[model samples]
Target: MKVDENNGTLAEARGLSGKKIKISKKGATPPPSVENKMSVGLIYVNEYYSGWKELCFRVLQSKFDSPERSFAPDQEIIEALKNCSIGQEMNLKQVQKLCMPFIRFKKDEAREVGTQALDLKLPFSEMDVLRENLELIRRQLGLEHVEVLSAFEVLSACDETAHAKAGENVKTAESESAVPW
Candidate 1:
């Protein structure tokens, strides 16, 4: 994938089949201060649409751009937060709910709340906790300084490639199964 350095938008992606997909984000030009500090990537979650993911990206970006808001937490607190798990398969609404307190509360209070939330045993194993937290941090930080593409866009492209390959497989199978007249 490639980003447009001027605006932090995803300018292109090379799909598995060597097809190039270009994405254009509306009104995505970051201010001078944030321009050089930003990056872009893609995340795929099961069963969510691109539009929903796009909405989440927009909301997170708005929060980061708000003059009154600051997302910096104490490094120690951020390290502690590293143990917290934000589950996969979470939709935009679910993530918004999880992040609301962090957005509203003071840094220390938010850390405490996040610690408590992380303590709950939610059917995920200990190994998965680290992975989940990493994803959470990526989303949070990505909102502030990265442009995240919708997973559906990339996944759909791969799916299309898979279907085309499958069609070719079926044709080959049928021809092989037939007798040479």
Candidate 2:
């Protein structure tokens, strides 16, 4: 394919083998075997962390007016997220935190984690809601005696969460409430 020098389109003048870079507005044609769909772990390689989030945030903010400053660039952020899951294993919490830059979860339901750690499907909008209401949930649950429910047995006990049912406390909250003032 011929690229015009006037338009800043890169042309492969030589028989390219290694370290040939192409920059063109009208993209180069892919090889016959190459599928049109994007690969699962496409990444933009650079020496540094590529200015981190702040640079991108400022760039995006400049593109939008003040009213749209808080608005997240959903498409751009999702594409960036694809790069994060590359060549690494991540739990649901890690994935959730990763996508938090773009969104938050809103509901109390446990995260439906993927069987494989890397194949996370954390969505931004849902995460945004979760982030906003996390404090409220912690307060509602009264996390004074916070317990980690790591196993099925422990989580199942939540269904019958009372000393009366477990035969632990002789005077249960129910019994205390039943007493007249």
Candidate 3:
């Protein structure tokens, strides 16, 4: 899957090595076959105080004018979100905090994501209807929480023990498959 920045067409194709791929709009394409489908993690900026909601919305609107920004997300959309600066005048820290337990699924549910990243609003009030509607969509779509990288997991995964354990698991699987059946 490759997202064209100039034209907003997402192309899906296999590479020379017969691996699925996703090329981001920003030209950063990670190795394919890492994951079956692309999973985008959302970072919700909770309102800090009174009027903070308005400010946060404004900051968001400056980048994404879509009413469905909260729901549907893609590569470019997530990148725009991370780069948004909040309360520049107030000297507040930017939204750099990444939350854990990302909203993900085992299978590809890209169609269930929100509308396209357009600047125009939908006919209905998406914000008002989102809370109730999103739950229904999730249940209907069978979305589930998948494992995402954590601080501890990231650190532990790089050690020699983790590598050895992975090797042992592969060997065990191979041995088990050797049974005549």
Leading candidate by lDDT: 1
Worst 10 residues of 1 by lDDT: 9-18
All candidates: CA RMSD (Å): 20.8, 26.3, 18.6
lDDT agreement with native, every candidate: 0.34, 0.31, 0.32
Per residue, candidate 3 scores C-alpha lDDT tens digits across 1-181 of: 1114212211111122224455778988776454554333111111111132333333334444244334334444345444444323233123323210111220122124333322133334433343334443333333342121222222245445533434434454335333221
Scored by lDDT, model 2 comes in at 0.31
Clashing pairs in 3: 1-21, 72-114
lDDT of 3 at 136: 38
Which run of 10 residues does model 3 get worst, by summed lDDT?
41-50
Candidate 3, residue 25: lDDT: 84
Compute the lDDT for candidate 3.
Answer: 0.32
TM-score of candidate 1 versus the correct structure, residues matched by position: 0.19
lDDT of 2 by residue, 17-109 (tens): 112333356877444233332222111111111222332333333333333223345555444444453214445455445444434221111
- Candidate 1 lDDT tens digits, 80-103: 233334324355456446444543
Error of 2 at 33 (Å): 71
